[model samples]
Target chain A: MQKNKLIAGVSAGGLALLSSPAFAQSIDETVNHLFASATGWFVNFIFSPFPGTSFPWIVAWLVVAATVFTFYFTFIQFRAFKHSISLVKGDYSDPNDAGEVSHFQALATALSGTVGLGNIAGVAVAVGIGGPGATFWMILAGLMGMASKFTECTLGVKYRNEYADGTVSGGPMYYLTKGFAERGLPGGRFLAILFSIFCILGALGGGNMFQANQAHQQISGILGDFPGWITGVVFALVVFAVIVGGLKSIAKVTEKVVPFMGVMYVGAAIIILLVNADQIGWAFGQIFAGAFTGLGVAGGMVGALIQGFKRAAFSNEAGVGSAAIAHSAVRTKEPITEGFVSLLEPFIDTVVICTMTALVIIITGQLSIDPATGNYLTEGGRIVTVTGASGVGLTSAAFESAFSWFPYVLAIAVILFAFSTMISWSYYGLKAWTYLFGEGKTTEVVFKVIFCIFVVIGAAANLGPVIDFSDAAIFAMAVVNITGLYCLMPIVKRELTSYLARLESGEIKKFK
Target chain B: MATKYIVACDGSSASGRAIKVAVEQAKLNGASLLLVHVLEWSPYSFLTPEELEERHKRRNEELKRAQLALVDPLVESLSSEGVESSAIIRYGHVSETIADIAEKEGAAQIFVGRTGQSTLTKLIFGSVAASLAQIAPVPCTIVP
Candidate 1:
């Protein structure tokens, strides 16, 4: 007990010292020095071949890759948006269909998993660091992302397994194995196993820990120094309850919750934009200027574009194939129906919701730079900002400046969004886990328990490096997933042509 | 005194035709007709208990009035032809209520129309129909 008290006393003293103006300034200086050194190292690595080569250049390369993919797929994302809406509405239900849930429910479940922090925090980070111009590139990246979603989800349904009892299992694992096996590849199973492992890791990190940490931060920020352990415990309990009930339960909850939370949050942002009415034009000007002129942030035009594209890619997760796992369980025989619905993900996420966040941040003028040093400042101290989480707080503050009670509303929305996301992602990770490990009830339950525990850990721990790592893990998964989609494009084209033929022939009628 | 059959009518033209077919089949088999129409629980499930009860009662009356309108015409026609028929109004999910009424009425068969008010095509053969088909105690037919 004496030792514990002494440690506590020492920590409090350290904190007090850290909070002093002199100490804080010194800390800032130290951080700047460290950042400079790190930036130098990164610059050297990136520019080894040429002095001007940088990380943003690599990001530009990724954007080109995504853009090329979008074109190669014949701009299917734009052409299929309306059809995607109809698909979700289940306008073409066949009696002999062989799946578990409606297309809308599948999209809802998948959206619930993908639409969380990415829309709220991810957008903010893109606009915050990348400048307003990032929004333009982000939207473009999201458009390309749609084709990726279409390819992956179609493959998810096409390669799904129907068990003896009529339950279904699918996703990248199934396609990598079954699709590749059909091509007479000797190592199809091995590749599938590897994909599943990556998916599980990606799910656990990006899907579970990242979500929980942000949720915990938001709750703790509102509640004011509430023990991290308490937040973790509550989050774990709620997550355990829903996930234990399995995918159907998760789907049911997400179907209801995703729509409600989405409308509420988006509606709030719309209200803010309306209130700011006249400044809307100026905000757009800043975004476009910051995007092209590269006058705002340190990274220049290329840096800004990369930040925007990276954030959007991270947000919608179109190419990742994780969302396809959720969509695969949808009850329908037509793989194309779910694929169509899956395309709406990036639209709602990056285009609509992310745009709203960018508007709020930009219109409020809270993200403006200091004229003397060209550094950004908020609340009068050198802005101690991490990308996603800090961006969400900036948005909340903007709303609070406009409407006094909006902070509370934003907090509630964040919790609901985060909670729904965590639950849906638990299913995604578990499927991947089951695909690689043995599929037993016990195995699933154990995974749920571990996932829930991470919620607490994520909520409590310092997550700056952790979330970065998690985001990287998710991007890595996208690399593999998009590769598979590229290779399997021919199959998607075949399915699309066949389905469109049937539609044209009137063999499938619209819902009466 | 052959086995009775329950046929549900929802007041649509298709439902009317379905009832006619069901009654003709029942008459041919020497079975009685027990026509039923179910009034669903309200969409506003988040209301207060008193409000809910009032809503439920009002819905019940509406259903009763509709059922009587359907049954009177059929009864008059049947009685003139020296045939027997009866009708009922119940409150619940359409499929579940139909299954329950069938068991209680000792029905040997059940009949339904193909579509309902909700334009959701997927749901027509979805959970409700799937459940009834799997667990209904009698054979069921859906007339398009």
Candidate 2:
């Protein structure tokens, strides 16, 4: 509720850096000289052509696609929301179906892909830039994004190819090529190739590297700075083990870990919020008030919306189509049921987890605001940006406010999140690689080994260009995926209609 | 036959003992032994068409492998010792499948292993031995 909650009460670690002028100044100068110019231009280029604003049009592209899908599906995300939950609970799944995993396992695996460091760091970054008001828009984006997830994942299952060996491969590449061919479309092959390339890049960069980097940041903050290579090497090794074991192992771990970690994270957040119960109402007021008026942010309402939309896109990755890969593994004869299952992903990842992170940051009062123009003071530097350390550190600080040793807990959670994301992405990238390279033991191992190597590079390298490339690669995937979605949406719609009819007729029995 | 006995084997020592017991029972009753092994297979029930086909294919392979590795060897050993024996392998829930085979074969009794799961593990995931004992259409014995 206080206006000047910033510049003061940084967590113990944050406070130490902020209080020491010599250390902070030197680090700031070095970081600025090293990365600011490079990142600034790269960011501007990616986000350029937003007409009146420098806002990343890719964010707008994602939001608009979500909105369109929501309207096109006649709010399927809303109407089928209950069915979606039940589908994830495996009510309609027929064990006789031809897939490797259950509906719930597929949902959990996809969720692990979507609910990574993005839920942790991405939310704090949104709130850091957009203030508390961003939470509203973030939830909005998540809700709409569900429909896009539905469309893509349905296509994923419908068009997935099963090798003679019993393993299945899916995602946008399968759908774009196979679906388009069914429709006699011209660009199916071309689009499929394009999507595969981007997906591979995205898998390595955002999926593996960025996760490693953020996990490194969180761990180093708690454990004291060790060489980033150590975190990378360990992550690389663990990721290798799970991935080399095969999709079943990844599915097994994700189904258990994602739910447990989600509960633990949200449980901790709920406890913290309950402890600060007095500020609960006040925090909502701030979120609402800041959302429309921009809370005196630099770009006003536009900035808040941009940050919320951008971070939500980055977090849940609804239209980005990576989730389709994970979801396609579901053992459902009805592909649409997996679609129903996937729609819950963004809801859980962004609407639930991301919002929790934001609320924690807001309620714990970690954001540093300027009293003059009511503008939040964001200190930009090398790796750790923002004056009070926004992103995961801000989230960490918020939790640290409640318990002195909570940073350690946050570190463990981050590593787990990072680990799960990497494993899921390994599957995604492998599918994409095999799409281009053809499926075999050798090709799959090649993709996996490359993925693990990037984990090390991501942890060890300075983040600036790596994050830029990762972000660009991810956006590149979204570009290709959304294009294919627009082309194949009619088929998705038909599937949706038939599924609803079957559901109503009780053709799809509820085994649960 | 004077009497027929079904012995379920899972390549475990308890099941081996059960096989021995079934042999002894068949010998005493001047009957025959139906040596059977059920591979535990429960589909998640959500596979795509291709995966489902593969699962069914794998199920057949598993049944064949079990018959070769488990039931065939046990049946051969029994025949060598002058216990009239036949072998079959199936894939399904362990207890139910065993019951089904015994019913279909018109066996007079059933013998099963009592190992593979501790009480706590059994509580978490249903114990096949306990379930078989409860649901067996014929007289059932659990050999430890």
Candidate 3:
């Protein structure tokens, strides 16, 4: 045992040394690559012979898409926020409901999936890279994201299928295929297949690996020199135990864990803000000025705006169809009821948690650039670079600066957030995988095992390129999912009208 | 000999009522009470086996603390009333394990709290409670 321990320690140390240098070198190369790619994309978009531009131009396209979607939906997310709360309270619970889990449980489960590291680390990254001004744009993007979530979740419910054994299955794939089939669109099947493929890839990378990587980092950071494989092996085992039992197990675990973690993390942030009371005003000032003037460490106003918008988009994921899969499992006949509940996602994730993280970072004055390299510096003397994503290390520094001995707390929170995210994303990816690869138990196990393997890779390898690739995959999913939503908006409108009519007739109130 | 009833209770107020309702039904049917609580594993799935077990043990202890706080009082009250009852705690999923325990213990009735929907509606559309009711191969009463 002693010899094994020595060997293990040496191997881990050697691996870390080898990987760290490679990671550092690759980060520089990746940053240069991103700049070149962005430059090329921008030039092509501006000077192309065609009137149109590239798909993801300046990250403003995401904001504009959200804006257009919000207006087109007539601000459904804002108007229906309270109604969503009531839906979760089971004010509209009916046995005749066609879906599976309770609206509250579904919302909790879905929230568990979305409200992970994005809120903590992602927000920190945004503020670190974009400065205080990024916070303003994140809030703006979050507000608009509410509408996008509303549209997709409603459609997810409307097109769901119930099996003979009374299990409900639905998501973007169902809506994309069935909604289009209803409209006699020729390529509905093809688009659905494409969306499912992206969802599977996304689930494995963004959902699974991203989550495990953060959790592993936190554990290793706090506990000191634990083997990386320990995290992967243990994570896979625990995840396997739950997921193998299927959605019911996942739901039960999520319902309990998500609420507790959400309250705890948010409570901690609120306490930090209260402790740092004096700096709040100055933080707000910096945020506003940096937002407009683009005078922060990120170079210009456009760069700051892009970082904020990108982070918010990453954080809330309003356009991505992943959350809709979880929401679709809700037990409700009224699709709009679930949609109302879905709006709370952005409110809780971006509007509340992300905002708190931004405040904690900004108020702590950690958003300032280092005089040496123009990069943001944490209190711990580490130069905070904005290679791709900015959430984890920055948030940890902010919490540490405030609480002093609170790195453990932030680390624990990161583990819980990331772990919950991976488990929930497993469901999303599995659903997407099952949709495409056939829903055999064997196939699921294969996907899950592969997914678990990536957890180690994500933790051990440089995430700069991998996370970017995964983020792009998720964004690609959004592009496909939102297009499907656009095509199926009429169905959502009809479902909303029908549910509203039922509400007017006192049919829903009878349950109360 | 009267058949036993297994009552699965979380610490929620509704679950407290479920225990009360199960006790009353057991008394009426001349059945014994087997109170059970299931504690779920935490989301820190990335911990080692020893760590996972350690976490589970910690959670089990917490659950035991809650059970003692809630169930001990009820057990004492029932003994004072000259009623015989027992409590069992398991660490697993609520629905499937509840059904499994009911079957193993030869429970004639299964009682659970209706946290999400009312018993009547959940009966028709089915829920965790309804799923238990359908598959437990025994009568189930969901207490709201």
RMSD of each: 11.5, 8.3, 12.3
lDDT string, candidate 3, A350-392, tens digits: 8898999888877766655667854355433222543322458
Off by over 4 Å in 3: A1-55, A58-61, A94-100, A225-230, A244-255, A369-390, A505-507, B1-144
Candidate 2 residue runs with Cα over 4 Å from true position: A1-44, A95-100, A237-259, A369-387, A440-446, B1-9, B16-64, B71-112, B116-141
Q: Which one is best on lDDT? A: 2
Q: Write model 2 residue lDDT over A1-512, tens digit each, in one string.
A: 11122112213324555787444323323332333343456456666756876577888889889999999999998899898877766566553341235666566556767787888888887887788888989999999999999999999989988767555678899899899999988898898899899889889888988899899888888778776666877988877877775445544654556567778889999999999999999898888888898776657677788888888888888899898887766546788888888898889899889988989888887876576866556444111223357567888888888888888878877887887777667777887898999978998888888888778767765665666767777888888899999999999899888978987898877866
Q: What is the interface RMSD of candidate 3, in Å?
A: 13.2
TM-score per candidate, chains pooled: 0.71, 0.80, 0.69
DockQ for model 3 equals: 0.04
lDDT string for model 1 (A333-396, tens) is 5787778888898888888888898888878776766779654443322133422236567777
Count of backbone clashes, every candidate in sequence = 3, 14, 5
lDDT of 2: 0.77
Q: Which candidate has the top score in TM-score?
A: 2
- In angstroms, the error of model 2 at A167 is 2.3
* DockQ of each candidate, alpha-carbon based: 0.05, 0.16, 0.04
Better of 2 and 3 by TM-score: 2
Tens-digit lDDT string for candidate 1 (B55-128): 32444456557756766777677667655778877655677778987887789888776654465765554644
